[model samples]
Target: MEESEILRRGLDAFAELGYAATTMRELARRLEVSHNFINDRYGSKEKFWRAVVDFALLDVQSELDHRMAVGRDDGERLRNVIVQLYRLSAKASAMNRLMSDESTRDSSRLDYLHQRFIKPFWDSIEPTISSLIAAGRIPDAPTHIWYFAVTGPALALAQDPIADRLNPAASPMAEQDRNGMADALSSLVLQGLLPLSRGDATDRNG
Candidate 1:
């Protein structure tokens, strides 16, 4: 099978089983290949894991970059970036799961993922995020808090069972409803979450 297919499947396996539970042979089995295929090709589970991470992140980075480029101004760009990430988190559910799993520990896996993906992703958006901070439009919390607040709902759209149970609609949300939800969520981050910062500014000025 092609390497891309292996990487895609590996992403799902690692996200589901996590690093400690996943085995090279199990991955090969999932691929329907010889049990030792992964070990032979990647030399070890660690190398294969890195390859999978790199492959998934490359695609994410590309999409984010494109979204950033299309914006006409900083505010628009920042909003676009947030919207795109929300879509990606739901669309690339495995990546969201893997991020949540790795973030709970202090392992080299977290370090590797952070150094490779999280930090860089933050760096790209920091200037825009910071501008909002400077303008007193968002909370003055630590960077990591902002990261979590923005991404905490990554699984909300995918919890089909829970959403279906809670939602009163007879059918699933229409595309229009989904789009509206996305917009509302973005507004919550960009506007709703800023009351604290705005209050602080108000106190200082008045």
Candidate 2:
């Protein structure tokens, strides 16, 4: 099988079956390849996970591009961005499950995710973040906090029954939802947090 196809199958299997439960043998079986073939192709489970990270990042980059292309207004742009992020969270719940479920089993793997996937994801999203800063909507909001507020809902989607209680999952958000979420988050940065330090805020308010 093609290398990408093999990796894709491995991701699906890992997500569905859990990382430990999904062995190279099972992955090979799912991909209709011999166990030895799987080993030869990916070397080890860790290597396969590294490939999944690349696959996931590629998906994220494409989603960000699509959202960026779809709108002009800040609210509209932000809404589309939220939708993209939410979808990614839902699709990758398995990875989150692994993090929570197997954290003790292999702490290093989770650390790898924080280093490779999470940090880089934040870096990649920085430009859009800088856009909000430039617009003065979030002049005082730290970039990392802005990152959390914008992406938190997406992460919430992966919740099991326990987490659902803390943050319920609604439908994929209608226009009103988008507007409400965007307005609330924007206000948290603009009106709730430290007021804009720039002279523009004074002029506008005065």
Q: What are the root-mean-square deviations of the candidates from the true structure over C-alphas?
A: 5.8, 7.2
Model 2 CA lDDT for position 61? 58
lDDT (C-alpha) at residue 132 in model 2: 66
- List where candidate 2 sits over 4 angstroms from the true fold: 1-9, 16-34, 73-75, 95-121, 134-136, 160-206
Tens-place lDDT digits, model 1, residues 1-206:
88899899999999889998988678878888888787888888888888888987887877887898897666667778878887776666677778888889998889999999888788888887788788876668898888877667654544545666677473454333555566667667766654435654575488
Q: Write the per-residue lDDT of candidate 2 for residues 72-191, one digit (tens) a residue.
A: 554445555655666556556655454445444656667777686666666655666577668776555787677667666555444545544544565333212444444455445334
TM-score of 2: 0.56
> Model 1 — TM-score against the truth?
0.79
Worst 10 residues of 1 by lDDT: 170-179
Give lDDT: candidate 1, residue 17.
Answer: 96
Question: Top TM-score: which candidate number?
Answer: 1
lDDT of each: 0.76, 0.62
